[model samples]
Target: MYSPLVQPAVSGASSGSRESTRDNVLNSVLTHGPVSAATIGDQLQLTAAAVRRHLDSLEKDGLVEVKSVAGSRGAGRPSRRYVVTQQGQSHLGDDYLDLASEAVRLLQEISGDEAIRSLARKHFASLEQRFSELVPEDADLTDRIRALTRTLDEAGFAASTRRAGRGGKVTTLRAAQICQGHCPIQEMAGEFPEFCEEETELFARLLEVDVRRLSTLPTGGHVCTTHVPLGRRAHASLMAHTAQRAEK
Candidate 1:
């Protein structure tokens, strides 16, 4: 019957979705790790069975390691916590990270810290130029934000945007949060935060609004969050322009 043909396709789709969920579980461990399965489930909204299935798979692949932590006094046995292995960390590292770090070190040795900062600025400037071109000249703040988010996502930063403020509406509060779930150069940036500083300035120029970086992955936060204040006076006009652009 037709049901026989559809059954295999449906099973394949479910398998693919589970595979994707396993990847998500690995990333969750990479970001906020040395955590318990229950904790990861809470953050990802997955059931304990689903989380355990992914964890077991990751362990088999040697991407995760488990540690037994002593429970409270008079409680049962120790709890099992999971953390990413060195191999798992390397999986998340940028392929060119070694070359980039060498280049930075050579620059520092040949010139000075100022030279390194200059190069960082130049590097981010190029990214800013590329991303700026994607936004229309007359595009409002929301469009600009969306474009930048897309740009960052394409660059492997896993960027996203959300309304944040008292009313939880961009029109009402005129502010939004830009969050980057991954940073390719996180380790390098920890030593030289000039990279972070330059990128923040680039975001300000591209968006034409004041932006504040609240946290970053290099700084031990789960995500890099930038607070962008859109100004109340232009809210209505910007929303109107965004709607017009959408219609066209």
Candidate 2:
């Protein structure tokens, strides 16, 4: 569930104190829309000075813009209301890969290719481990493949399946154009060629059946394939076994 409030709750102290303050201020403005710094300070429980400093940082990032408007009844000076720019909204979600890529570029700039490669390997390993958790325990081959397909769909893969024969199933996934637009690593292919390979391997391992990749189908501008298994009912006991495992 998402919060309907103007800002997400602050969890802990941020780096350099002021840096975090700036992020909080910018995020608040982005989430809530045009609001005064004083109103922002009250919401964040930060001092006016601190809010100003943070706002300054945000302005530097081109993430926040201010609009000056006269106060009701024409006050002495116009009040400046802050709002998040389109750029700032990009930073608000877990899907901020552009920011991650910028971080990677900085790391590569400072540390060199070898360092980035090492970091990429470590990161990919972590991602693989996290993805593995989505697997249901004791799920047979077919069900596992279905689950994996569903996971891919959630991850922006336009996944669908077709029954090939009495015992065969073919799964096709088309990648979303939006996903490719933001991807940094040669889009998805060069960055994660191993992605499909691993998915194929997982399906094979979980089902104890041969999972073969078919010819490439056009998606966006690149190509992808269908994952097909030769037979059905090969893993009939999957769900029941999975349930039993859960009971344990």
Name the best candidate (by TM-score). 1
Cα lDDT listed for each candidate: 0.71, 0.50
* Per-residue accuracy of model 2 over 1-248 as CA lDDT, tens digit each: 11221234562345557566666676566444456888777778877877787788888887777878798799678889786554554444436565666776687689876655455545445434544686667776555555555544444333334444332234333111111111123233234344345444444444455456553221222223444554433353654543342232
Question: What's model 2's overall lDDT?
Answer: 0.50
lDDT of 1: 0.71
Q: For model 1, state the Cα shift of residue 177 in Å.
A: 0.9
Q: For candidate 2, what is the TM-score?
A: 0.34
- Residue-level lDDT of model 1, residues 208-237, one tens digit each, is 676789988787765688888866333455
Q: In candidate 2, which residue pairs get closer than 3 Å at backbone N, Cα or C atoms, i.e. clash?
A: 141-207, 167-231, 167-232
Worst 10 residues of 2 by lDDT: 174-183
Sliding window of 10 residues with minimal summed lDDT for model 1: 1-10
Off by over 4 Å in 1: 1-21, 24-52, 55-89, 168-174, 232-248
Q: What are the clash counts of all predictions, listed in order?
A: 0, 3
- Find the number of clashing residue pairs for candidate 2: 3
